[model samples]
Target: MDFNGIKGTYDVIFSLGKNCLVADQLSRHMLRKIGGVLDWVESPALPGVSHLLRNQFMNFMEFPNLAITGINEHAGCYIVRDAAYHIFSHHDFPLPENTPTQLLSYPELREKITRRVPRFLDTLRSSNRILFIRTEGTIHETAELLEVLNMQVAGEFNLLVINHAPVSGIVETPWPFPNVCALQIPLVPDEFHDNDYLWKTLLEGFHVRY
Candidate 1:
């Protein structure tokens, strides 16, 4: 999965300016390349956690092969809440020290969201899903990060990791998963270009065409 959104919020906080446009275009391109589609589901746009989970779960039920990516750590907490009733629910995970209950006031809710993002990612790792995280900083070598992601995605329907910067370093850790692959590249101009490169790379690497 390709990620070209803001950290924590998963929102397209880029402005309408040229650089922002370039970034958005690059994101779209990457999505197309990965044999995936990008959709912007803002937090405010949804009624709440339950609504977001219900909508995504129903959508996935209709398209099991489809994978939803680009959710930040904060947004992912709602996923845990939504899956709470399931047998292998994420609700079993322990909350972090600073996370406030929803019963708290608005400021508390905001603080909780900020603190729980990392915890949410940890919880998400236990689930069977695929989640692509966008790293910070400039684009660079990323072989090491890709290796980590490969292990995380193997067997699990869902995976989560931090995208701290561009892919640049070589993998020093042992590779775990053979099936999953991570593709890292510099940001492009638009979705069309991004898709072209993404599909080409996948086709070459995995013989899978987008």
Candidate 2:
């Protein structure tokens, strides 16, 4: 099932009184604006469908005058988050024996993943679209990297730098990119640390007016 379906399922399962009510209302509102499940299902299968849906829903409910773009942005703007470690680490920790050897810290694993980074960057640069980078580990030099990559991509295309890091490491730097904007989110602990409070805070942070 899709993200909306999954969220609806959770609302039904938890039945968190007013919270559930709000979610149901928002879900129904979104469905109405987007022309029901048929329209949503027909939407292009893109990586950032959830973001697109949220943006659309916000425009419909909160800012009716806003001329929100559709799924075309998926092709026109490529948001590339750091997946070098994630893509490689998925093979280990909880997967069955059929996992690939590269995930096992086999010889030259780091080099193998590092080698692909340039190719991925090249592909993004070649595209006639804005490339938004969410630098994962290397937070300190993100602004510099964003400018450098933006130059390589299209100087005219907008470049957005989203610092998803919990800390203010690299974002403190003074490097400026014309098209870059920083979106910072506070760090929340994992389930083991403080699951309920963390999740509740996150939900509150993302609450919609609808």
Q: Report the error of model 1 at residue 201, Å.
A: 11
lDDT digits (tens) for residues 65-141 of candidate 1: 22222223533322222222121112112234223333122344334435444443343344343333222211222
Model 2, position 199: C-alpha lDDT score: 29
- Candidate 1 local accuracy as lDDT? 0.28
lDDT of 2 by residue, 1-210 (tens): 111211211101111111122223334333211112112112122222223222322222111221222222323321111121111122112223223221233233234434433543444445443323232223344444444544454323442222334652223322344444444333445312323332243223222111
**How much is the lDDT of residue 187 in candidate 2?**
45
